[model samples]
Target chain A: MFQVNADVIAKEEVIPGVFSLTIVSPVISENAKPGQFVHIACNQGGNFILRRPFSIHRIVPGKAFEILFRVVGRGTEALSRVKVYDILDVIGPLGNGFKYSERITSALLVAGGLGLAPLLYLAEELTNEQVKFYPMLGAQTKTKLLRYIDFKRIGKKTYVATDDGSSGHNGTVADLLNRTIHYIRPEIIYACGPEPMLRKVAQTADEFGVKCQVSLETKMACGVGVCLGCACVTRQGYKMVCKDGPVFDARDIIWDKEEIEPTLLGGYRCETAKVSDPG
Target chain B: MKNPVMPASGTFGAGREYSEFIDLNCLGALVVKTVTLRPRDGNAPPRLYEVSSGMLNSIGLQNEGIDHFIEHDLPYLRQFDVPIIINIAGNTLEEYAQLCREIKGVEGISGIELNISCPNIKAGGIAFGASSRLAEQVTAAARYNTDLPLIVKLTPNVYNVSKIAQAVVYGGANAVSLINTLVGMSIDTNTFKPHLGNITGGLSGPAIKPVAVRMVWEVAQTVKVPIIGIGGINSTLDAIEFLLAGATAVAIGTANFVNPRVMIEIIDGIESFLRQRNMSDIRQIIGKVKV
Candidate 1:
């Protein structure tokens, strides 16, 4: 990963509290894989001291890349106001990304809320790789279902789910997958979203005996995996989400560590993973 | 030009993560995270929160035991030509001795840094370092347990940091690393609650530089051992300030998050500073503050 000052070419609100920033960084756009992420230094003038981790939303090799974010806290709010031409200190493409396998042909792409960030790039790659896939997108409301058109433009079948019933399916995206998994008969599933939806999807994939990969989100201090702040417990033990993976096999994640409600976004609850045996 | 630039323990994991960005050979030493006798789960979630000019983290010293380090992490770090210093923590003096005994004769290790400054753990962390007597005891126990060079790390939360430094040196420490993260806390105005999951956390970054410099300056007069200054050291100028304040070397901590290559940049900058000044040795300028 290289640390470079990327010039913001475009910054626009995709939704009310969410934004898309197109950055000019050839090195990042050129080497960034589907599941890799960028750690962005927010406006230093603001109260932000930690670099915010964002998944690469899109990449244009030798030129630029795009990242999507939501104004969840002061750091992101500070970032949303960044004007075009403002320089952003970007370090990426960090963390292990989605695993590419030549064995899988039919795949399922699942995204929730801002989780659509990484999956957008993954979909582009799967399309290029001649992999047959379906995009399943979900959000709290229809207005929050981000970039559905972008997924559709890939000329692949896309599905939508929202809690308020304003969108295509009136339940969680996992519900959509459950209803369609049989007909779709996907050999592999890649997901990025709220922990609860991911947990449900992981469980469904397990029952269906399909391989699943998930991208997890956590409050991280150093995106380079030093601080040990963003550790997630797996059956193997504690692993840094920024290093061992921001992406992992669904089977490896210790789903019991976190209790996520199927439909409640804010009802998500998780505890830090314990070090099983330090020795 | 032996410009000693290493990453502080806990801040630089096993040097695996940043090694992908910068060459490990650029550093003077690699101080791995603190390992206690038993595995520590660390604190609850919300382990870190960004402050105004720094961050508050209560990671609670989460690490695999020293055996895990010897069996797994040590081999990976040994591939680099640089010296490796294993930082160790314990709940009691015996535990510290046990850790030392375990690490004794371990290949690829050049030194042991006794961590008596972790603020997050409830027992025998900052507690031992807060008092000169306890600090001396732990330092002496660790010193007696191993033949490796022992560097005692002191906490900034102490009332008389110089006393602690002197006590550790007298207890047989070969050197001392000063000004581990200071104890601090922040409250979320919106939630009317503490920001860190541990309620309070250790603060680090540019905000703590002046205090760290002052502490190093004070400790320099009390102890004869070399001082490894740490706290808010992001640049060569920062490292130079510590050296002038009586530190022989400085470790970069929080800045690693801002840019993984910061330590390398600081090393280069220090070398350039010396070359431009035509200085033959770094010792000529160390502790030369006129004031």
Candidate 2:
């Protein structure tokens, strides 16, 4: 929960419109965990006041962490032009991260497009804990699939799925998971992606009797709990995604009309199907 | 006094949310989100859109209503010693009076901040504050309903903020909080549609700071009641600027989203500035800005 002016040590375009920034901030790096995120201030001047939130894509504990973001709107576009050594006011390692039981020996990591950000970090955490897992990367096409090479280096095998049959499987990633779950028999499922894909994954996981944790996204003003802009309806009540979770149990989300109100992306197109993903 | 630093209503939900990151007691006061007469789901999604130096939000005053606040939120807030100013808004004057009456005997509440100018909603929001007569009517109605201190939170969207401020004071408001979010909107050029689902929202953040300071200064000269300056106050310097412009206190709104510890930081900064100046009290600097 510390706010620091992090020095951007490295910045690269992971893919067209998508960026990865490696920041030097020991406090945040040391405190951050998988599935947690950082809310970054875009610029100092009045033009970009709101801080944009990004999941911690990766971390190098006690030294620095990485944030992966897509150039969606003004904030991300402004962030894309930031050069190395620029200071970013970042407050985070925020929200509760993914939760898994110690007894779970086998896990499945699922991601949709840029949604792969947080799960990449979670995969590393699971690796360190000796939890055997497989990574499933999904995109609209082969070119959109991100970090497959990276995932292969970490997991037993990185499964690829594409909506256009441009890569591995020809259907949605959740369909691929549904087909493979019987063979893998994973004890738990962890996912981060668009809501529809997440919902599908949650359903499939339930059908297989496996526990599932998901990282959710919403338009947030304050990434801390103060602003209720990012409220998500749960079985209990409206929960602040910035505070209660950016990560939550799939079963807890209502996914009904009440919950559906805040999840509206307006006219923003789905980034997965539209954005170009690098294989 | 604990350097007048409080969370602006709507920006700080129930006190429980930020309690983990901030000690509630450290603030001069805590202003909860607007509580209407009944539970409100608020506006549709796409509730927020970032603008030049701030963001526009049409949260539509969403809350669990007054009953839920009294039952669930009040207990949690009562644990903290900080003065609680419950911000209430209504679709009508009766609703405002009813809310004041309902909250009158609440154990932990120190005052009620009548929300006369919430710009997001389609109904009673900014409409009340846009006109001096309606603003006075609502203030008088709420004032008659309770014996508690009444603070009318004014909207900056109006042409004459000072005129509205004076009217509310004449109607029996003990104090006034200036510059609720200015009404603004954005467009999604790609889709050729308005950015916010509600079509418009109240704009807050650093961009609104100048407008707020000007309004506070104007209202200060027009009315003798204390003014709680709100809008775009992110640091101690901004708070001091407001105080110097004639605000007795300042509320942190959009800045709370950027930094949870902003109010505490502002409080610490004010004390430092006052101590450095060898001023014995903060009042010496209030409205001290020289032409």
TM-score top scorer: 1
Q: Which stretches of candidate 1 lie over 4 Å from their true place?
A: A44-47, A81-87, A100-102, A174-185, A203-211, A255-279, B38-41, B186-197, B272-285, B288-291
Q: What DockQ does candidate 2 have relative to the true complex?
A: 0.28
Residue-level lDDT tens digits of model 1 in B1-291 = 146889999988898888888999878999999987766666655678888788888888887677788889999999998999999988888999999999878899999999999888877888899999999999999989999999999999988999999899988999999889988999988999887767888999989999999999999988889999999887789999999999999999998887788898899888888889999678866788779
Q: How does residue A251 of candidate 2 score in lDDT?
A: 88
What lDDT does candidate 2 reach at residue B128?
92
TM-score of model 2 relative to the true fold?
A: 0.85
> For model 2, how does the per-residue alpha-carbon lDDT over B151-201 read when each residue is reduced to its tens digit?
999999878888999999989999999889988989988899998877888
Which candidate should be chosen as best, given DockQ against the real structure?
A: 1
State candidate 1's DockQ: 0.32
Q: Calculate candidate 1's fnat.
A: 0.43
lDDT of 2 at A67: 91
Q: For all the models shown, what interface RMSD does each have?
A: 7.6, 6.5
- Model 1's CAPRI class? acceptable
lDDT of 1 by residue, A60-122 (tens): 878999999999888798899999999999999899999976567788999988888999999
Please write out the lDDT profile of model 2 over residues A46-158, one tens digit for every residue: 47778888999999889999999899888899999999999899987899999865567888999998999999898888888877889999999888788898888889778
TM agreement with the true structure for every prediction:
0.87, 0.85
Clash totals, every prediction:
3, 4
